[model samples]
Target: MTEIGEVIELNRFDETSQVDDPDLARALARRKATFGASSVLFYDKPIHMASASGSWMQAADGTRYLDLYNNVPCIGHSHPAVAEAIGRQAAVLNTNTRYLVDIVHDYAERLLAEYPAGLDNVVLTCTGSESNDLALRMAEAFTGKRGVIVTDLAYHGNSASTTAISPGSRSDRSVPAHVRTVAPPEAFRSGDNDPGGSFAARVRGAIASLEAEGHGCAAIIVDTIFSSDGVYAGPPGLVDGAVAAVHEAGGLYIADEVQPGFARTGDAMWGFARHGAMPDMVTMGKPMGNGFPMSGVVSRPDVLTAFCEMHAGYFNTFGGNPLAAAAGLAVLDTIRSEGLLENARAAGKTMMEGLRAMQGSGSAIGDVRGAGCFLGVEISEPGSNRPDAAMARKVINGLKERGVLVGATGPHGNVLKIRPPLCFGEAEALVFFGAMEQVLAL
Candidate 1:
């Protein structure tokens, strides 16, 4: 069996695979020559996408595929409001922070309002990796410690510093000297009835280990939804004990909201809020600008002050530019106008209940978990909890062939990651569920 937290690099078509489409073959050759080892195309026979709108994406061959995998288009694909805002701002001015920009301030104020009281200051970045990297620095500067604790399967970012803390990204599962990893809050697999308490105990142990190593704890950063750790969202307040432990150890709790923010979790704007845990710092991305490449870190003013005083002030050339700010504002407006939060709640409930019903029929589904638009369906061996990556791959490809798009994620790569646009409705949900049933039957 593959080790837990190991990223399953799905099978991709190589030169040996027989290709009938000449254009696709040429495209694949060009991609290989250009991107080399870094090129990762989804599906065995990759679909060349032409365009996308709302919840539907069209392939180059004119086949329409229902998008159940993309979360970046939080409002919807090619949303007119966001596109218009970007265009209007780009045509007028697209300068950096060197200039006095009201739009930037306006967007910052709007975003900060969604956060809790103490998390007032905002530092925009170009991606979630950059936001997390900066948050780590702030924690180290404020706490005067070097150690960080994260979940065993966490994938924070791609930067050197962030990668040091993201064990999932590392092939060897090795972490830096200043980092320690704890088990995720997985209720299904855990023997203990009190999953929260069990998780907190592991966190405390990691803290002790870090302290003993002379690297006092700086922060306990986590994806509040634990998306990569099999999408574990608890029975409300499941993370309370863990947060308290971090606080008692004088460590900040940094919530990586890249996967669960922007009302993706249905009930709240931020995933940590779902558990009633207020993080000292929150990093957001993916849906911030509705796929306009914007991200930010929200922290208390005192924490920002300490970090800036200790080091040079921070700035990104493309972060929070006028165009990005406009797009972000437009996304926020669309969410309100469309009532996307309520839509996500309703649509997610339908999807979850449908999946649970399918599970009750004694299928290969070992578990169905998550909230709102973000959900995970674990494929496992029949009569056992053992993960079945082969089944997951089959289901993913089967869905693709049937004009539905979904992806595989989790420690063992057996969980179907279903996160569509916030605009996903009952009609779209029915399409997905019906297609899923058909695929499973096959």
Candidate 2:
């Protein structure tokens, strides 16, 4: 199996290789020249140019592809409401968070209204990384501890502190002494029995390990869905044990909702709500502004106050700008007016049923799991559990060639990650299956 955080070249474009399409070749060369080795592009033959709308993206050559992998534009690409709100706000006023802004409060009130009681305050940030970084600080400040526990393949953010806790960020770097890793609560791995309790026991062990090493447990942070660990959404209350274990050890539970928030899970507005886990702090982003770069942390007032009292105070120049707030407000309005929650519920059910059926008929699909719009189909060697990274790559590229877009995740890079925009519907789901069938030779 591939190591966690190891670069899966199977799913990435090779820079030194070749390009047949002159237009695409020229574009790739130019990008390579400018971005150098830091550039990360998907597909072996990357498509050039793109404009997108609703649930589809058009290639530079004007070919349309069904979108099944983008989660950033939760309300759909180029949504008119969000675009208009952003345009209107930018044309009128876009300023720093230092000033009092009515629209900011309006957005905050609407956003916070969905959160559980005592998660009464919100601190806006420019990205999920910033939100997680701030959350780490808050947990330390509140608990006076220096340790964190996370799932083995978890990816919280890219900041230095978050990187230390994110095992999937890199296996090259040794985990910091204060941070410990545990397996995610995926049902299949646990034989469909007591996966939740197993995950909790792992957390408890990690907490003890941290304490034994002189760093008391400060927090247990998780995405709940475990998207990077191959989309492990589950039977209800899966996170209850882990949350209780952390709390028992005097550690906070920071729910990193960057992946599963804003009704992506269908059953609830936030992923943690599905399991009824109460987080001491919750961080969210990506879909907050339908791709407008708005992100934030929410916590009880006392928890927030604890951090502020220990420092010069937290602030971000562009975090809660009126423009971002307008975009966020538009997203909220769209989710409500479009009935995306109910759509996610219904559409997700259709997808789950379809994928499960696909699994029964094919050896390539080892497993099918996830909730709502976020799901994963594990690709495996025929008649065995061995991971088939090459097969996964083939399916991904094959689907792409047939005008569909998806992604790969899991340490083995063998699971097809199928998370589309919240605007995804039965029509979009049907398009995905049509492409999947052809790709799998079913």
Highest lDDT scorer: 1
lDDT of candidate 2 at residue 106, scale 0 to 100: 98
Worst 10 residues of 1 by lDDT: 5-14
In model 1, residue pairs whose N, Cα or C atoms come closer than 3 Å (at least 3 residues apart or on different chains), thus clashing, are none
lDDT of 2: 0.88
Q: Evaluate all candidate structures by whole-model CA lDDT and list the values in order.
A: 0.89, 0.88
lDDT of 1 by residue, 1-442 (tens): 4455345465355556767888888888898899998887888888788899999999888999999998899999999999999999989999898788999999999998888799999999999999999999999999999999999889999999999999887767789899999888887655568888888999999999999999999999999889878898877887889989988999999999999999999988889988977899999998999999999999989899999999988989999899999999999888888999999998889999998888844587888989899999999886678888888889999988989998887778888989999999888888888888998887
For each candidate in turn, give its C-alpha RMSD to the true structure in angstroms. Answer: 1.3, 1.4
Tell how far residue 90 is off in model 2, in angstroms.
1.0
Question: What residue runs in model 2 are displaced by over 4 Å at the alpha carbon?
Answer: 1-7, 171-173, 190-192
TM-score (C-alpha) between model 2 and the true structure = 0.97
Candidate 1 accuracy as lDDT: 0.89
Task: Report the lDDT of model 2 for residue 302.
Answer: 88
